[model samples]
Target: MELQFLGSGDAFGSGGRFNTCFYVRDARGAFLIDCGASSMIAIRKFGIDPNTIRAVLITHLHGDHFGGLPFFILDAQLVSRRTAPLIIAGPPGLRDRLTTAMETFFPGSTRVERRFVSEIRELEPRCTHDVEGIAVTPFVVKHPCGAPPFALRLTVDGKTLCYSGDTEWVDGLRDAATGADLFIAETYFFDKQVRFHLDYATLARHLPELGVKRVVLTHMNPGMLARVAETGCEAAEDGMVLTV
Candidate 1:
């Protein structure tokens, strides 16, 4: 399996990095972990064909997490002229949130007739679901984003990948990363303990307990980015790719 960091910045675009988006591909299919507000721009900048993506797994409804769906869908309809079906899996009320976001961005966009089909699957917390042949398990995390935030564990082609999507030090993270080939976690700060975000120091202290084979930290602020070398884990940067 191949994992690509489309964007690895925090909500503020710290260090001029783009927002959070991870592209995962394997023999089964290709999918995006999170489509942040800058995701479409990053996809184009990185020379990725949007039509090749089969599904997008969203962790929460935050703008920096799942805000680019409208642009992506419109691009698929107008630019790519794509006819392949796209699945968007997220927490409950996904359809409503997406519609609201679309309308907020472009008036009447959600009602427009489209060439491709966009399917929204509302994922129940702690339930494993099949998304375009990939098995995905979402565990509810500590972030409060108007809905149940999740840390996702995905299994595709016999490989497992976990993502700790913008959460603090929660026990659910262990469940999300346990026995995974790669764990992409959000280390937003170096050592400062902020609410609803992870710190590198806290993660480092508990890394052994997580039991993941490899750890890559993403969604970093400027302070965390500067101190990444000291964290003893790979720091994810935009356009970086990893094969697992």
Candidate 2:
């Protein structure tokens, strides 16, 4: 499978990067890890066809993490005229959050007639579910975004990928990332400890416990971006692609 960083910036668009979105595609099909507000723009910029995406697995309900659903769904219906079913899995209240977001973005948008079916699955913490072909296990994290945020473990095509989502140091991540092919972590800061955000130093201290094959840092602020070279770990950038 091939994973691409469609958008790698944090909520504030630090380093002039786009919001947090990742795209994965292989012989089976394609899916998205996170679809932030700028994901539509990033997808278009990367010349990706929205119709090919089978599912979107969200990490949390933050605008920079899940806000692009409104545009993605509307575009699929009005522009792509898609007929394939789309699976969206996330934390509890994801369905209601997307509905409110859609309506807030474009009034009465959810009630529109569409040729495709959009399925919403509210994932439970520690329990795994098969969404289309990807296996997803959500672990509750510390970010308080109306609904609970999650650190995710996803396995597909014999490759496992874990994401820290957006949180401080949490032991659950060790379980989520242990023996994974890739761990996409959120390094919001370089070394300064911040509430509800991970720092590079904190992640590094626990890296050995994770037992991850590879680590790619994402959702970084300016502080983290500036010191990425200091971390020596792979740092995600817009449009960077990795094959797993």
Candidate 3:
């Protein structure tokens, strides 16, 4: 299995990083963890074919995390002429939220017919859902996004990958990342405690307890970006790829 950081920045694109998007490819197929608003551009720039993505697993309803679906669907319909099924799995009310976002942006885009089938699956928190042979479990996290935010644990090709999607220091993270091959976490700051966001210092304090094989920090703001090297943890960079 291979993991690629397509966009590793915070919501504001701090340090010139793109929004939060990660591409995961296994023997079965390729899928995305979060399709941020800047994902389409980042995908194209990185020479990745959008059609190769079989599914998209969303963590929350925030624009930076879930806003690119509309554009991706439109592009697949109009430009790529894609006809394969695309699975978009997320928290409850995903279908409704995407429809609302589509209409708000394109004003009747949801009404347009498309060549491909867009499958929307509302994931039950703490329950494992299978997406095209990949197993994904969403664990509720502490974030106020008008809905329950999730930290995902994905199992594919005999490997596990965990993502701490935008949240403060939460005990649930230990369970989410336990025995995983990679733990992609959000370290928005170096040491300063912020509301609804994780800081590097707190994460470092609990690193041994998490017990993951590897930990890479993402969703960094300017402050975190500046001190990434000092944190002594691998920091994700846009376009960086890792194999496990």
Candidate 4:
């Protein structure tokens, strides 16, 4: 499996990074891990076909993580003229959040059942679900949201990818990343102790316990990528690609 960093910046697009979005693909179809607000622009910048994305696995309802869906659907219909069905999966409130997002941004745009359509699946925490051919398990994390936050562990083609979706340091993180090929953890702050965001120092302290073979720091802010350390752990760029 190949993981592409579609956008690696945080909510503010620090260091000129777009946002926290990624594309995972292989011989099978491609899937988007997160649809951050700047994902479409970054996808176009990388010269990748956005229509190639077959599904989206959202972690939460935050704008930085899921605000790009409405525009992406519109772009696919209007600019790309895509006709394939799209699948979106997330926490319990995913359908409602996407519906509201569509209404707020593109009013009356959800009536595209005649054209392309989306199958939004709301997952129960700690429950495993099947998406297309990928087996995904959602784990709760520490994030202040109306609904519980989650991280995703995806296994496809015998490859595993763990995503720490905008979480603070939580015990479930070790379980989420256990025995994964690559752990994509968010590091939003530099070294300070923050409530909802992860920092480098805290991650370093917990790294040895997680037993993650390879880690890629993502969802970074300007301070992160700008002063990113060369400590064997890679920090994701706008177009960085990793094969697992």
Q: Against the unseen true structure, what C-alpha lDDT does each candidate score?
A: 0.92, 0.93, 0.91, 0.86
TM-score, candidate 3, is 0.98
Q: Clashes in model 3: which pairs?
A: none
Off by over 4 Å in 4: none
lDDT of 3 at 182: 92
Runs of candidate 3 exceeding 4 Å displacement: none
Q: Which digits, one per residue and each the tens of the lDDT, describe model 1 over residues 83-165? A: 99999999987889999999989999988898888899999878789999989999989998898999999999898999999
Better of 1 and 2 by TM-score: 2
lDDT of 2 by residue, 1-244 (tens): 8999999999999999999999999668999998999999999999999999999999999999999999999999998889999999999999999999999989999998889999999999999999898889998888989998999999999999998999998777777889999999999999999899999999999998778899999989887888899999999999999998
Cα lDDT over the full model 4: 0.86
Order of candidate numbers by lDDT, starting with the best: 2, 1, 3, 4
Better of 1 and 2 by lDDT: 2
| Superposed model 1: Cα runs more than 4 Å off | none
lDDT of 3 at 211: 78
Worst 10 residues of 1 by lDDT: 223-232
Q: Which lDDT tens digits does candidate 3 get at residues 8-80? A: 9999999898898999989977999999999899999999889999999999989999998988888899888
Residue-pair clash count for candidate 3: 0
Using TM-score, rank the candidates from best to worst: 2, 3, 1, 4
Better of 1 and 4 by lDDT: 1
